[model samples]
Target: MAPPLDPEVLRAALVTRGSGWTEVEHHDSIGSTNARATRLGRPWVVVVADHQSAGRGRLARRWDAPPGRSVAVSATVPVPASGAGWLPLLTGLAVTEAVEATTSLAAVLKWPNDVLLPSDDDRKVSGILCEVVTARAGPLVVIGAGINVSQSRAQLPVETATSLLLAGARVTESTGTDLVVAYLQRLADRYAALVEAPVTGGALAGPTGLSGLAAEYRTRCSTLGRRVRMTRAETNGAIDVVGVAVDIDAEGRLVIDGPGGPTAWAAGDVVHVRLDG
Candidate 1:
């Protein structure tokens, strides 16, 4: 097993002049960082684990990484109910940017929350999850993220996943600590920018808010402009649609121009398909 996270080292790495982050709890292993983070009432606090017994991804999918080869983290941030919807998208962007900047890889997002290598040779490298919690102080959003780092080919959990080591991430010299620090730093700046925008006037798409964010998301997304098989869940049941993905609207929904017509979806499993299909 890898050495557990040292709080003093993390404190030195995480300290920012004006950032409000106060506490950090590290574990060699845990059930889930997200589950633990939601139980904490304080904002700007973070939880991290080297291994997870029951880590989960979107749609309650099982997710975990090999110990010492992944970074699993969860952070709590105070946010309004209106802004809560944007956290998932924002978290996705944060992770993508952080990975690209840190690893020097052509990383991109695969809509909603998966981060991939590139469009032509795409493979999942990271996943993000955002959940809401209520406490005595108010409401908070717990953002959880996991990244495959130094794992070798034989160690990968799935055939469709890649790692920083495989991607030739030259800058990943130190360890996972650098990655956690980088991701949290970027997330902090992104969250601060979101807080500066107007929360009441739908300014999430406006200048001060997530304005150009959607466009960045679009550019880095391998889903748009490709044929996709989408499976979306509903209260009644589930439906599958095969279509050409056109755009991601300001609300972060996937716009699909399909055989029947055009539809936008908020949640779906997107499988990129060939034109022959």
Candidate 2:
């Protein structure tokens, strides 16, 4: 098991840097940090758990890693209703950066939310999910992420997944804390940019929502310029849509070119196939 987080140390680390964190809590075990953060209803509050008994991923898939071997956490952020759609993309970027910093690895994103370490042959190092909750005060976006940290070779849950330690991350207590702090800082900065975007006239849904945010996402996205197989949102039987992922449009949809034409998908399971030569 990993050492428990030291709140005082975390607080001092941020304060000494002329930065500060909002309410934060750490638990040795929990059902899900996202569930806890959502239930708490406190903006900027963060909850982290060493182990989750019932963590979930996109489409209700299970997400779990051994205690102290990963980062399973969630945070609540205040955002305008119009900016809710941007949270997932922004969080993906934040997690990717944090993993890269902690691991000293080139981390890339597989769109719609997986973080990969190239040293692990593009194996997944983290996953993210963003949710919006309505409250009388306004809208709150709850973001959850799980990052594999120090799992032994035999402990990985899936063949496609990898831990930071396995991918050459300096997996110490301080390294994990740094990873968490880095992610929170990045999220706070990106969220500010997203909120400052013009919400009037549906501007929040366009590329104008955040200056250069789309381009940045594109640069980190491994799906772009690659052939992909996507599970269709609407299925007639089990048919899927296979195409080349070419872009992330103004509204953050993955634009693909198929046998017919370019179609922007708002939601689906995307599997990276190969680069389109």
Candidate 3:
């Protein structure tokens, strides 16, 4: 088991000069960081909880971690509704970057919201969820991230999930705090650039627009250049689209080349297909 978060240390580091943070709150136990962050209803407010009694993941799936076994944090920030689709992708990229920089783990993104460790057979180390909330000021995006920190193999909720300790990354209390600080800093920098990117003629621009970010996401994404299955819900029911993930479009949709040609999906569950013969 890793040491519990040092709340005082975290506050001191994050509330420093020009950290781009308005408020930072750390909880020893909470229902959900995302829920609390949304209620906070302010931009640049970060809420972190060591234990979530009612944590949830994509598609409202329950995500539970024992006390101090994971890093659960949520941050609210203002973002354009037009570019809202990019929040999850941006958060995933930021998490992987932070984990890799703070520890000895090589992390990669699995489309929309998962951070995976290839060394561990693509097991997930972190999951991200973004929610757009309307406040008196404007629209704010609450980005929540759950990172497995010190769970043993037996303690993992699923066989596909692994923690920093399980993946051979040392997890001291300071290191854990460092990871959170790093992710917040990176997310703030990228979000600032993304918000300033202009929207003209209803199309995002290239390079100067989200193209640079799109390109970066593609490079870090392990879903590209692989056969995959995408489950999407339609008017009728949920349908599975099997295809090769070709690219991430300018608007942050996944472009899949399948039997019916190419289709772009804004939201769906993506699973990489592995063929063993």
Candidate 4:
């Protein structure tokens, strides 16, 4: 078991920062930090948990983190509904940077959501989920990030997942706390940029081109420039679309060229297809 988070230390490190993080709350355990933040409905607040019992991933997939083994954080930020879709991608950048900074490991995004450490067979080390909520002030996006910090390989919930420690992070008891702080700082900076950039009516979606968020996402995303097999969203079928993922369009959809032509997918399970060239 990892050392429990000291709320005082976290508060001390973050409360005075200029990130607009209004409140930082730590929990010994929680069902889901996202649920908590959504219920709170306060913008610029961060809710963190040492253990998340009912954490979820995209498509209602369960994300299991045993007590003290991972860092689960949900941060609330208000954004225009039109720009809400970019939050998850922005959060992915935050997680990638934080994990790389904290663990000294090369982290890349597996487009749409999962954060992967390439050294660990491209296994996912973190995951992001964004939920749009209606708030009195406006629209709020609860950005949830679950990062595996100290879990050993045997302790992982799946073979395709990895932790910072397993991926060569020199972790101490403060590893979880360190990751949370770094992640939130990165998120706050990126979120501010997302909010400040001008939104224009163009081929791209959201306030991306002006902000350069989409361009940055493309650089960190490993899904681009690779052949992929995507699970069909409509039928829940496997490999309905097999193509080369070429780009992320203005609206943040995955652009792929298949047997027919270039198509943009809004959401689906994408598997990188390794081929012998």
Candidate achieving the largest TM-score: 3
- lDDT score, candidate 3, position 187: 89
Ranking by lDDT: 3, 4, 2, 1
Lowest summed lDDT across 10 adjacent residues in model 3 is found at 232-241
lDDT of 2 by residue, 243-271 (tens): 89999876788988998889898887888
Better of 1 and 4 by TM-score: 4
Whole-model Cα lDDT per candidate?
0.77, 0.79, 0.85, 0.83
> Arrange candidates by TM-score, highest first: which order?
3, 4, 2, 1
Q: On a 0 to 1 TM-score scale, where does candidate 2 land against the true structure?
A: 0.90
Regarding lDDT, does 2 or 3 come out ahead?
3
Give residue 187's lDDT in candidate 2 (0 to 100): 79
TM-score of each: 0.89, 0.90, 0.94, 0.93
State which candidate, 3 or 4, has the greater TM-score.
3
**Clash number by candidate, in order:** 0, 0, 0, 3
Candidate 1's residue-wise lDDT over 1-277, tens digit each?
Answer: 3344565667777765676677889988899999998888778998988788788888777887777777789999998544455567778888888787666788877778798886326888898888778977788888899888777778877888887777777634455676777788878877776666555565465666766556666777888988888885553335478889998876678889998888888887887897676
Give the alpha carbon lDDT tens digit for every residue of 170-204 in model 4: 88877777878888888888777766666566333
Worst 10 residues of 4 by lDDT: 202-211
Per-model C-alpha RMSD: 2.6, 2.9, 1.8, 2.3
Q: Report residue 69 deviation for candidate 1 (angstroms).
A: 1.6
